[model samples]
Target: MSATALATWTVVALLGVMTPGIDTVLVLRHTIVGGGRSGLAAVGGIAAGCLVWAVASLAGLAALLAASTLAYDIVRIAGAVYLVWLGLSAIWKTLPRHRTEGGGVDALDAPGVSARVALRAGFFTNLLNPKVGVFYISLLPQFLPVGPAATAWGIVLVAIHLGVTFLWYPALIALAARARGVLLRGRVRAWMERVTAVVLIGVGVRLATTP
Candidate 1:
């Protein structure tokens, strides 16, 4: 990629990374409950997702999905269901008696999610989101040059985007981790869990209802 093109892609990547979204919320929640390790796991998961989207874009897979209604619907529903499942799981964990067991564990004791699980969740979340496919099929290509180098350059651009996202999320996780003390207090922790549950559910609902 040319210097100007690389710079422009960097700026776009940074902007997209900084924007708060479901991934951001999920990472923050993990940070608050499980500290830096969990936060990193979440970031890794999200990066895995981005990589899948990047590859799909390069392979023209996203374009094929975009052109097929049945394919799009299947992926969209799957994404919606996954988000709802996550939200409900969060809510269930926040129930009065269940709250103390999971949320109050030390970061080390919990050790957060397994790397493989996180990566898989991250990959599928982004891969299954039709919106992401559309973005890759439409928006990303607009910035790519034509010819044999297009796919290669697109991969580089996506790497830059993922780098920004990975960098940004850790900062967010650190900030949330610092607040762990306050968040761990009985009522405060409970409230935070409740809030996170609601946010997850809202995102799920929105995804399900969106056209």
Candidate 2:
């Protein structure tokens, strides 16, 4: 790809990554609950998801999804369900007596979550997000050249997008982690958990109902 094309893609990817979405929420939740390491894993997963979408778009698999209502519905419902489950799980943890322990930097030092679960969550989150697939199918192609370099440039653009996303989430995670000390005490913790739970559920419901 030309230098200009690469630069343009970088700018576009940065802008896209800066826009808040499900992945952003996920990272923030992990950071607040589990600390920086968990947040990083969440970001890694999200990036992998985005990469999956990019690959599917480039391979025209996303087009097939767009064309088949059944396929689209299947993925959409599955994603929505997963999101709702995640949200509800967060909410469940907010129960008055329940205390979340481990599963953060400390957990990372130990056995921690399986790599498969992390990668799967990341991949599925992006893959099941039809909006992301549509975005890649539509927006990505506009900047892509129609030549032997097309696929190569497409991958470059995706990598840039993933990099920007990764960069953004870490900053958010760090900020949340820093603020955790103040937010983790007294009613603030409970309130924050509730708010996060509500936000996740709201987003899940919206995704489920949207056309």
Candidate 3:
């Protein structure tokens, strides 16, 4: 691909990364509660999901989801349910009632789960969403340079997408980490959790309602 084409693809991929959605909310929530490492794990999961879609798109499997309404609906509904469940779980845990002792930096800084578990949370969250597969199927082809090495070109494009994630997700993690002192406060953490829950639920509703 020419420099211009690469630049264009970068701009588009960055925009997609910066879009605030369930993934962002999840990362932000985890970052606030479990610090930067947890958030980064989620980003890894999101990246892994994108890569999986990239492979599927290359294999022509993603096109099947676009053509088969039943397959699309099944995946969409599952994603919606998973998103809502995550949102509700966040809301439930952050309720003011669960005021455990030592409600300070130590508790707030602790990982909610193991790193592997956190990673899995991220992997499943993205893997289960068919929109991502469909998105790659549609968007990647537009950026592919006409050549015998089109598959190689496609991988490069996906790498650009992953590059955007690396850039955007870490900055977010750092920002959340910087605000760790304030986020450690119970009330602030509660409100943050509420905001995350709302975002997740809103995304789920939009996903479920959208065609």
Output the number of the TM-score-best candidate: 3
Mind giving the per-residue lDDT tens digits that candidate 1 earns over 114-154? 44445555666776688877877787887888899888888
RMSD of each predicted structure: 2.9, 4.1, 2.3
lDDT of 2 by residue, 1-211 (tens): 5788788888888878888877777777666656677778777888877777888989988898878888877788878887787668666666654553543322212122234444455567776788888888888888888888889888878878888887887788778888977776666666776787788788778888985
- Candidate 3, superposed: residue stretches over 4 Å from native: 101-114
CA lDDT scores, all candidates in order: 0.74, 0.73, 0.80
Which of candidates 1 and 2 reaches a greater TM-score? 1
Q: What does the lDDT come to for candidate 1?
A: 0.74
lDDT, ranked from best to worst: 3, 1, 2
TM-score for all predictions? 0.88, 0.86, 0.90
| Highest lDDT scorer | 3
TM-score of 1: 0.88
What tens-digit string does per-residue lDDT give for candidate 3 at 31-139?
Answer: 7787787889888988998899899998889999999999998888888888888778777776545545566423432334355656776887788798898889998
